[model samples]
Target: MQKFFKVYIPIVIALILTGCKEEVKKPADSPIKENEPSSIAVTTASILKEKPKNLAAPEGMVWIPGGELKQGAVPQDKMAMQHEKPAIDVLVDGFFMDITEVTNAQFKKFVAETGYITTAERAIDWEELKKQVPEGTEKPHDSVLQPGALTFKKTKTSVPNLYDFSQWWHWTIGADWRHPNGPDSSIEGKDDYPVVQISFEDALAYCEWAGRRLPTEAEWELAARAGKKGTTFFWGDDISVLQQRANTWEGEFPVTNTKTDGFELRAPVKSYSPNEYGLYDMAGNVWEWTSDWYNNNYYKEVNTTGEVQKNPQGATIPFTPNNPYAKEKVIKGGSFLCSASYCASYRVSARMGSSMDSSLEHTGFRTVATVAMLE
Candidate 1:
């Protein structure tokens, strides 16, 4: 079989070459829409046969009482990308999850106590960084290298199309979780907001300190679905009610924000209603890190077995034909930037792979604990 791709923009190619940008499904990979029944075989990873007793409930944590899960896009999600198809069934043990994303106040406390610094706070090592780029790529001067994170910038006018992500995403210097927008920006009075500009490493550090771990992809989907099996959007198949349920972009993406949802950027945790699991910001707000090493073709493997997997952790190593040099982890739950016109990653089964060291204003994470962790 012969495959060919047309490169419309050089900047996007450069971003892809650098392996710095967030993953977006190509227009060619757009989902098929029709009144179609879901292909997912129904099975419940549902319920613990016996609940662990005598374990005190952790603060701000809830047990995700599992039920049925179809661990991929349902037929109702017309916007689902090619990668989200071939939904499969799986079982997950009950685990306690943070009610909301790790908040600024919580991360601040961790930094204050441990004197730890985040990836966005460290100066860029061009030599190490360029490894992800081409071998002959020109290096910028030392003065140009600074610590920062990627941030979304609104374009003055609407772009011709949504294919070029670089039109809206920017790598700004001096931007971090504390200074979300930039060095000039501050998180003061927004302690309740989810922490952004957090890398996978940073999330792991926080999880370690909290005596919890990042949820596996299966765990994340199970929690988000919350027994609402074989449905789109985790809330239901209704895209019309997305505004009322999540803090996703509600206007011309990266151009004009109608603020229909009353937020132009990331909203405070619990700004929207929690799902059936009592977990807030699981569908949107900020993309949360997961423990899965994203393999672009892993879903195919899962479906081929035709057997239910138990407590399935994702691929042992990251695999994406787009960027082999970058070891990426799965980031679930879209962000405030996601919209129908852009990436509607808020769907429960929607997934994206981000570089392990990559940090952005729209990216954050939560923690989860097992019964053993408490006992």
Candidate 2:
């Protein structure tokens, strides 16, 4: 589902922090001696030097030799969302990530081998869903509880209310990874396209069978930035640069897509050039799932420490004020539906949260393999 709620203070604070500022000078009469190695510093240095055993790269994946990232939106972006605020120094360990989003062909292989069924293909559990809803509320109709997914349908005219995303998204029965639009649609010729209509659990299942796992939010952002620091977009600060670099809406969103980027919907996995790290579709195509539980204020926790966060696993619990009972995971990289006039989440630092059980037509994911996997 589209998230358009505006809470601007956090992002404004992030923007202010990104600008050039005077460095704080140490007190001349401070008791601690300068250059004296603290325990934290010593431990951080040791971790940086420790190397894991070399492993053969998984096919269709590339190694990201991660370092510290200024992980958040840059000051140049006035459209920065509140959740992308308070850019912090985060350190992630090197890991192997898929070169592109998990393709339909790849997911098909996993399903065929395991006979796995995705979340969207299963009937909804009314008993479990009732716990999340208000007590004593009337049960939804059986048709509403049928196996289905949220599918995007472009509007014939400009939507009267952009915030009401229901205008473009519909719960369509028989719409899963295989039948993207509905029962009438098929993935017959779209083997190379990134798989969509996936949930966090569905992606995790594929990862388990493949002997991989979803990347942590920190790792995903680091890779998407592609070694670039403090830039609005992954490529650069200029918004115009996105014209040929990614698959995002080129016209007024929901109403019409000009297809200036040669795509009305999802483009092939690597339709655009790879990022500096040799990772393709790192910016758009489909939002990739991360292992971390989402928390809008998670960045504040990262800033509490002087030592760089090493592969942070996000908050202890997922936090969504609107849906407290829904366990949500972080999704990064935006998707084909992103538009400057509507959803600008295509920016590297942007973050979105989706329920673990919620499947949508625009959502997909990639997997990551740690060095330990080799052993």
Candidate 3:
């Protein structure tokens, strides 16, 4: 699993070398024009053509006009890894997507309305353990069953090379969406935070209840790119002035988050500017779950299947090219915790996985759908 290489960095470097570089410069003044739709104020009316204000935010989908966009690394920068190799031409169809990640407030409403219990909210299934762990590996001691992971702060004095997730990810028993830390913790003040500890099934349930569905991996990526064809980021390639653009690691990775991005964990929904399509926080915030299986080679398979696949869910066989414990659903968009010192998956092609039974504070979700024809 450790041997599996991450493809984002190398691809980004390669793209920088060959692709037209756009300096990521922050404008001193607001760039919104009177005639143009404000990225922050996008309403459903904009996407669906004249709907109620309440319906505006829930436009629920965006049209990703299909076209030939550069699919992989062009120059193959040394930093570019092999998984994102063999750059190819691919296209995607228009789709509707949530304007923001499902917030704790929204997910709480789902639970309140349906009494739906998330997988992590329930006890671990003992029967399932038999399939993975050694026969006698004592049902994971209680100390190991705690909720939430320990986020370390790395400083000049602290070690930075550690990748052991267990050192941070503690399997706390009472840690679910409502209690991010454990039963002792609560969501009382964190209603605006992205709902975490959600399994793929949990996200699906919420989407189904809301008359929506999870976005395919392709749809998610297209949306994340926000109609900015061939750009490294939804806004542009320049990585500087990052504090104003997206929520990401400010200082050293796991250990020392300077909170320069105005956040330590997750931020309120719509806290950041939306991409060209009016999608907010698409780059960095929380790693969102998509409706796809884990497969390192999914992109290659997608290329072969079709150039403009409508819904490109990943292959069925569980496989994580980089992170092995991530053997369930695929996650996209690196979270606020992402850092160059550690994981640089904040890019468009980056991927992640979470067990159907497992959930974490860093994991959340958004929804998307095919564009609804004007009614």
Ranking by TM-score: 1, 2, 3
TM-score per candidate, in order?
A: 0.89, 0.86, 0.76
Error of 3 at 64 (Å): 3.9
Best by TM-score: 1
- The better-scoring model by TM-score among 1 and 3 is 1
Report the C-alpha lDDT of model 2 over 65-182, residue by residue, as the tens digit: 7576677767666666656666666667788889999999999999999999998898777787666655675566675567877678888988766655555666677899999888
Candidate 2 Cα lDDT to native = 0.74
Residue 172, candidate 3: C-alpha displacement in angstroms: 2.2
Tell me each candidate's RMSD, in Å, in order: 4.3, 9.1, 10.4
lDDT digits (tens) for residues 1-375 of candidate 1 = 001112233322343323334445444434443214434354443545234777766999988864445688776566677667677666788889999999999999999999989998997776676776657767765655677777778999977756566677666778899899988999999999999999899999998899999999989998998777677777888888889999988877778889898899989999988998899988889999999998888877777877767788987778877655668888899998887777789888889888788888888999999887888
Best of the candidates, lDDT: 1
Quote model 2's TM-score: 0.86
Global lDDT of each candidate: 0.78, 0.74, 0.60
* Clash pairs, model 1 backbone: none
For model 3, give the 10-residue run with minimal summed lDDT.
14-23
The predicted structure with the larger TM-score, 2 or 3, is 2
